[model samples]
Target: MTIKEFKLPDVGEGVAEGELVSWLVAPGDRVEEDQPVAEVETDKALVEVPSSYDGVVEELFAEEGQMVPVGDVIISFRVDEEGDGGGGATATDAEPADAQPDSPASDGSEPEPDAGEAGDDGADAEPDTPSGRTFAPPSARRLARELGVDVAAVDGSGPGGRVTEADVRAHAEGDAGSADADAADAPEPRPAPTPTDTGSDGRKSAVSKRDAGGSAASSATAAGGPEPAGRETTLATPATRKVARDRGVDLDDVPTDETRDGEAFVTADHVRAYADAVESAAEPTPEPGPTDDAPEPAPAGGAPETATASEATTASGDETVPYRGVRRTIGKQMERSKFTAPHVTHHDTAEVDSLVDAREDLKPTAEAEGVKLTYMPFVMKAIVAGLKRHPYLNSELREDDEEIVLKGDYNLGIAVATDAGLMVPVVESVDEKGLFELAEEVNDLAARARERKLKPAEMKGGTFTITNFGAIGGEYATPIINYPETAILGLGAIEERPVVRDGEVVPAPTLPLSLSIDHRVVDGAIAAEFANTVMEHLENPLLLLNE
Candidate 1:
């Protein structure tokens, strides 16, 4: 049998190492080529690693909590001889190969300790240590060392020789404490005692003297054992642990009430509760009203009419959800875009009465062609035509080395509001597609995006963005600038409004357009020109078809 080693592959841009989040297959389990074997988390995203060879598993070289560098061996598999030994394998009755001297057994056996006492005598360690002693997961060892507990004393409950943080904490609080108490009570050789201070009455106080003598000894004992009492205990899930780490919360000190299998498993709710408690404890209360200058009591049947904003925000029955996935991504990106780009908004109302009539005129043709014509299609077409006429606006801005870069390609972004969040999917080569084709493509992209089936590439490389908040009811808004691009156009709701035609006021369908442009890239004059171009297109809808 031949062994094939599967190395970790680079999953994202410039990533060197990834944490093994989970493994789908195990040693002795048959797997096929291109089958998912493990899920790895890079700095950017979580990606699954497919097996490179079809074979019976020979060994798993990387542990779940371990960070495996790109191109490093992660797993190996044994394949049959006639399988061409490339990336294919077949079952065999042969015995597994001998494990490496320092490797843990593939049968999910705990690694034995490198023969030595709990402390001291490092040279007396053994060569083949069990997974339990030497292979404690990253979080487990970190918790153990931080809490002054020995990892070797903890029993791991994770599958396939894995140790979790809970195991370490449980061992510290339960077994380790009892074991240390028993060891202290044992009849060991006593050390010489130091002298103590006497009280003012010339008599040694029983408790004070005992404490004085034990202080130094206690320090030494603590160095060799668990931490001193009264430190807070924290229990949380792996995901919650990650959140705590990101928020700079000391997981060892987070107070929790829930326990899983005798170990604390803190949920997101527990962390928030702990945070609230801490905030409340730290905040100072206002001083009580003065008695001499006693304020008058409230009138009978009278109370405060309104609650404070904080109280109102917190008192509602609505649930608070921590943002994840696309929403979280949108929040971060929008924040970055807003902070980086100096946005300037220009708002104006366009008389869309003619445009409405023009859309009605083309409705029959659009319906016959299996397309639903909307004002957006004409607006998009007009924008494309204007971009062709004024090429500078259809570009991206790059301020690197004190020089500005304006890209030429027109990759327009259409912001589609989904149930999850607002997603802006790019429509490439917008100047090329006709109105019907643009409508079809836009519909397909928006539908696919809401379904979460849009590729990452589809969400990027936008030169300009349009958000039709008008469809939902908005007049004009200072829309946030989509970063790397100079501008975003907000389309407000079309409503009947007074318009001046031939020096006479009359009711007409008017559309409010709010254009936000990056001041760093485009000046106010340029922004006005772009907005005017869009307004011209909407004011004369037939211009799009004529162009």
Candidate 2:
């Protein structure tokens, strides 16, 4: 059999490496060519890595959390013959497929972490460690360290004598203050701590067992160790732990949302909801005693009290959204841009009464050309005119070569906001495209970008970026430069505002604009000149026609 090693391709231009998010097909799994073998997250987007050869998967070279560089061998495929490899594995210039099947791939849907993933993500289930400790998940080990509890002293509550998250919490709390301590002190009746029944506080867990879908058992009963049958353990995820910690809520006290394998599971939502309820209940509400004619309804157990937001809607509240794929990528890119570029923002207002009227005049002409003309087309034209004069703003400083590279071609990056994150789809050779062409392309690109159908190539080779923040109702921001590019322009809402015309105040359509430039490549004078020239073109649509 011929073993073929498939290297991770450079999914996008200039992307050095990508994080191995998950393996879609594990070793020994049969797969066809182009069937995605793994999911990788680049700095720009989360993409699937398809198998280039049709064969059985031999080895997976990269772990889920490891960052593999471009051209690095990620997987090996074993084929029966030397030349009979290729079948259907080809990546074309089309919209990328969704990454992790469970994960919606940056579509703003945050799914719960799978129990299997949790093992690798937090559980350090290695048989032995350098610290001479038994197997436990990383989270449980961390909690043990935090509470000054020795893992060696605590009993394992997980399957196969594995240490669990709750085992450590209960150990640290002293397991009902320890039986010896109870004997030494006052003889107060206290329940002995059991892996299956007691909570972190060392009490018979008060969390309802009915919520735990399984018969009064535990979440990890499938692993099967020595856990009791009727007792249920309180289970909280890492995110829930953080929320409980921040709010000073006991993990044991937070009511269970559900039970996984008889273990009462409390999620981050459960903690937040419980905290909100507690806080709301603490507030003093003045209530007039039951009126003579009408009396307030009472529950079978007690009197009716004020309704808390949590009680009314248990699901509505703060959520712990994990920054994993594209959303995390955007954050890192923004941080790099903000920190690397010495930013200088200049805000200005342009009276665009004539430009608005010009768009209205050419609406029919644009429609006849199969394009719906918008102010963005006029803005693009005006930007190109300004860039032609102030070429420095449309250039980059090659720090590696220690020289300035002025781009002759105007490739504009139009920042489109989507539910996932802020994405910029590039429009190449803007100077060559007419108003109708620009309008159609912009419309197409924006629509596709929102739907996440734009290819990686469509987002590349940008000379300058323009973001229409006004569309989302905002004005004047220190827009971060799209890295490697020298400047970014921000457009605010174009609304009717009072402006001075011929020494007299009059209501006119005004557009607010903000420009952010990289001080290392662009001087204040050049930035000011570019801003003013762009505004001039915007104010007088005829100026763009002349250009």
Instruction: Give the top-scoring candidate (lDDT).
Output: 2
lDDT of each: 0.59, 0.64
For candidate 1, report its TM-score: 0.51
Cα lDDT of model 2 by residue, 461-525, tens digit:
99999999999998678788988899999999999999998999999999999999999988888
Report each candidate's C-alpha RMSD, comma-separated, in the order given: 16.8, 19.5
- 380-455: candidate 1 lDDT, tens digit per residue: 8777766666556666666666656566777788988765456678898887788888888898988886764555
Worst 10 residues of 2 by lDDT: 91-100
